[model samples]
Target: MFRQSLPAGIGRMMASMLGDSPPSSRQGADAFPSSQSFHTTATLAAIPDPYKVLGVDRNASAGDIKKAYYGLAKKYHPDTNKDPNAKEKFAEAQSAYELLSDAKKRETYDRFGSAAFDQNGGFDPNAAAGGNPFAGAGGFHGFGGGFPGGFAADINFEDLFGAFTGGARRAGRGRRGPFQEVLVGEDIEVQTNISFMEAAKGTSKDVVITPLTECGTCKGDGLKAGAKRSQCRQCNGSGTRVHFMQGGFQVAATCDACGGAGMIVPRGSECGTCRGNGVVRDKKTITVDIPGGVEDGMRLRVAGEGDAPPTGTQAAPGTRTQRGDLYVSIRVAPDHRFSRSGSDILYTASIPLTTALLGGEVTIPTLDGEVKVKVATGTGTGDRITLSGMGMKKLGGRSRGYTPTGDLKVEFKVAMPKYLTANQRTILEVLADEMNDKTARRTMNIGKDSPPSEAGNAPTDSQKNEGFLKSAWHKLMNATKNGDGGNSASNPSKKESDDAKKSDKESK
Candidate 1:
């Protein structure tokens, strides 16, 4: 509990956190506590010491301290790492390293035994309390298992040699004292609701959030109303009570239950107004500015104005830092008729078969307004009519209009008549007859462009004669012969008649 090291600074440290106390110096190197029998604690018997944390010797040079600190820092600096507890370990290492790295303080710690700096032990150098911004009578020590002390190995070697350059040199003076107050707000989360139109179009609203606030009785300070905080008699001003086991052979460290702080606070009893808890409870109302076109489950962040900081002056629990961000989750309702497709919108439309065949104009729906769509005759069902720039907005971008929208993908479904009158049937019949007659005449009359061998083309006389002779030959060949096997009257013998004529002509 000595070092509840947090991510921020001292003002908000619960029981005293993230703070810096600078050192005030005396004239020359003579001011150093380097002499023996003064501030040094290394040779002391039996106690597990802080030197093991930074891993340097009792007489390690300033350069050595620098080298040790850098190496450990690389292994634990939370900023350069992903380990969950790296920040705390790094802070601990830093505190130890900072104290040892100072040549003057290191000398003072070396000369005067650690007990010499103790308030009740006679020679109070105010040494530990002096420029060590982190010191307050007593705080955290690694004995509690917070972080391993000697894990870093990347320290600048020059530091091990006690060089005066780099971060090894000693400072003459620095700032130190009780600091003023700066309370940060608490962290919180919230949820919001919106309509589909609002989600698509956009809107803003106010939300009220309730979280654990400060305690008002103590006026934000954890003291009995009108009471003051006092130092713990058990631990004295040093803040921690020392235990001597086996008659002081082995010494142990423990926190003072009375002080609650490692050292002293106000005095006698807590502030009556707050009853020791430094804060009070209250509700916060915030105006949330929602950007347009936010989809469902989208989040919005509202800064500050979250839960109030808890109150207490002791060093027990950690204090709050900056007010947590507010997250607004968006919920968009779904539309019944329209379906979104990225930058395109889809919908269905119906039309009469006659209208589809004859061509006509159809009215289509759009975001801006409705417009008549041109239906080219012979347009197939599902013929799409893209009304450009009419669609859903692109989620993340800078655009004045909706994200490349599209409109009216009207799919035409042909509608035919279910019932017909007598006159209608008659007209259909007549139309069918006329079409058939036209097709027959066209088939019979071949144009001049028709190929010569086509059957429908104009017929010549020789062709007609050949066709007739072929028909006659088929008819005669099928006739029955007379009983005498001479001739059938129906079938003519032209070759015989020709022979007789030739004989008469020869006789003449």
Candidate 2:
């Protein structure tokens, strides 16, 4: 146990308690008569009645005793109250709580008063000289010795101070025991554009960056050669200041003068290169790697390529300064001929109507080159042809042999001719007649009694006068077969009737 020196007031009180005659009655008496007398008085004054110190009755419950001690401690803690006597009052409250809160100590105190634990009639002057007046007893000792049942261990100094300081004691101001390295550089972000093909395959480009770097002149010391250093006057070299807050709370913060370094160069000796800032803006070229399969608006990080720390400051004794990071955002240009879906590419190719109906070989365009593809007979518009492993490659190769390659999907669009020559129309008409004959034969085999009339032939008047239902059914069948619906006329015209009768007679 280590004993702290007593204050002037406590020393005077101790001396008065040790003398045979009252010191106040003596003319021109010294305030602290002797060192021995001072120690005795301090020990006696320290051992006050626990019930009186805590402001509770002798029969008060343990809960009552704790509540009183807590209230007094909150009112007297040095951090909360700025009064000169706050520390002493808090110590008294702590001592009272230690004795009254314990069942054994409270019972002993109740029966014997202050003398129960003191075997001697009065405190020994010789023992007081040794610094511990309550050496023999385990109870009611000052802060200098161990308590009766390890009672001092139960007191939480952090908790008591934390209630008022809000844990500021462990913040940035007091983190370092002697010195520590701190972050002084900031990260930077920029955007760049690349072609669509460059994005599909990987490409690299050099980028110029202008950012702050350590000054070369004065070697980042922020001072000229042989400059003198001095303690910071603003914070008295402690690197922190106490701030009085709105709610009667005091908080500790870093001192602005020294940037929490506790030392600075004298006023007349600033380095000229960085103008005492310790850093300067400079241009640097960095090569960036663009991986395949990266999407637009994606960001890539480049390590150790950003701003540098300020000059005139060194990292903590065992640590190194860390450079900032560079973030590069990518923009990919759009391709007119192709579109993408995840890892797959989509393209559309137009084919002639003859190639769609007759079937032929058509050349298809791809990313690498052109390739011949077979257009199956009757291939319709909007039909898709897939070429495997012809799309963009995966960004980072593959996983499980899957997602390594994409397919190129080619969609077919049939192009119809708008006009035909007279000779070509005549040949098409003859082909149409032959196709109709074959259709009529096929229909007759399926239970039709009569074959269909030839081209330029028509039906008789009776056939034209058939019931409206039969006429409509025949018209609908013809429209569907020809792929065209005629005008909405219900009856045949005069010229059509005459032609139909002539054709019917000829057929018969």
Candidate 3:
């Protein structure tokens, strides 16, 4: 098998293994007044150990597993390795160790755990083991072994160190600077809305918000009004105790008694109102700006408007609410006439048969206002009339037209009449005789709509052609029967308005 080298003890959170965890309290400790170099040197470095990598029970750790993983990863780590499978093997070892080392994670493994950690099944390492490609038919190797894990014996110290700790470079960031608080920004929430027109057209509006700010008094110092520092008796001015762990590597941390600053404050020094470190919690109002062209359910974020901190908190230190953010959720009410699609608006409009045929001006409702649009003489139903630049506001651009503007599609739904009058029917009969079934039948436009279940069945081609002819015949017969065929358009419709009124009354 191929082989490579890896440095030892890198990428692993060294403190997680041997050092005492931070105080049990959720709040962090007081800030340390000073910080020396926290960088680890050659003298301070520790050897690479699989136990360290997994963060496990040292007494329960094993060598076979580590050796197997180290071998595979060493081969493919790329830096010192050349085997293609080496990298995968290394990653496997890392994952296995991570789970086994964590107490909670290891407990799960002891149960019916699995390799599919993300699937919530369990964290398993051997679920899909590798094979030695060179092995024979039965996947048996000539080395007096089966290609079970197919891992070699060589270990890569260089790879181990680099992979475990991210090298000394990243480790530096984990070190202490001047001790500060567990500075957490304030969190806030707000409810807001935008109009459908504003959402489509894109507009900016102001929203008042409340947020947390810091107290000026203690200036974040948790001490009393006149409090001064007193030297710590235990551990002297050095605020912490240092001890060696994991062999010869030393660990140093804050003093438990004084909370790390190397000094204690007299009880009187505590602030009378805020108790010392000056930060206090208070709500302040602010104006947040919301931008336009936002969709329903979209959110507008205004940074910095939440609760403040209480000044003195963790070992690092705490500050009150400075500012959080405001998230405005846009909910545009549905307009009765228009529906929205992204930024476009849609609505249905109706026109009389005279206007559709002869042409005339019909009042069209635009978002800004209503305007009269000329229906050119002879305009058919389904004819589209576009009002350029009258769609929705562009997100970022202002100049451009035609394609940029929304198109208004006028789908003519030729409505005949709610009821017909005697005189109206007479004229309709004459018109039916003149045009026959040509335009009227074609404009019903039902066939292309949908299945019968959706819009009901369409008129048959023959049935449509007979509409005008039948109207004409009805008029002639009516005239001969002692009654005038003048109720075509203005009288009760063929739908039987009387029956409809009766049904409504009965339903009531």
TM-score to true structure, per model? 0.40, 0.49, 0.44
lDDT of 2 by residue, 149-180 (tens): 22121112222233233232222222231112
lDDT, model 1 = 0.48
Among these predictions, the greatest TM-score belongs to 2
Candidate ranking (TM-score, best to worst): 2, 3, 1
lDDT of each: 0.48, 0.60, 0.47
What lDDT, from 0 to 1, does candidate 2 have? 0.60
Q: Any idea what lDDT model 3 has?
A: 0.47
Question: Model 3 — TM-score against the truth?
Answer: 0.44
Model 3, 157-245: lDDT tens digits are: 22234324532221111112111112345566666667777766666665555444555666666665666656667647555545445
TM-score of 1: 0.40
User: Compared to the true structure, candidate 2 yields what TM-score?
Assistant: 0.49
Tell me the spans in candidate 1 whose CA falls farther than 4 Å from its real position.
1-187, 212-219, 229-281, 313-320, 342-344, 350-357, 378-383, 399-508
- For model 1, residues 1-508, the per-residue Cα lDDT tens digits are 1223221211122222222322236434333232211112222211123378788787777788788888889988644555767755665577566556656545555665343333221234443444321122222211232123221111112221221221211110111111111244555767788765455556788888775566756545566655555655776644445454331221223343532244333554665555455655557677787765566677775655565544464433332233444667776667665555554557666787778878998877765567888888887777777766565555565477535433435567777778644344433433444456443322211122323567767666654544444344334434433253334434357657877899999999
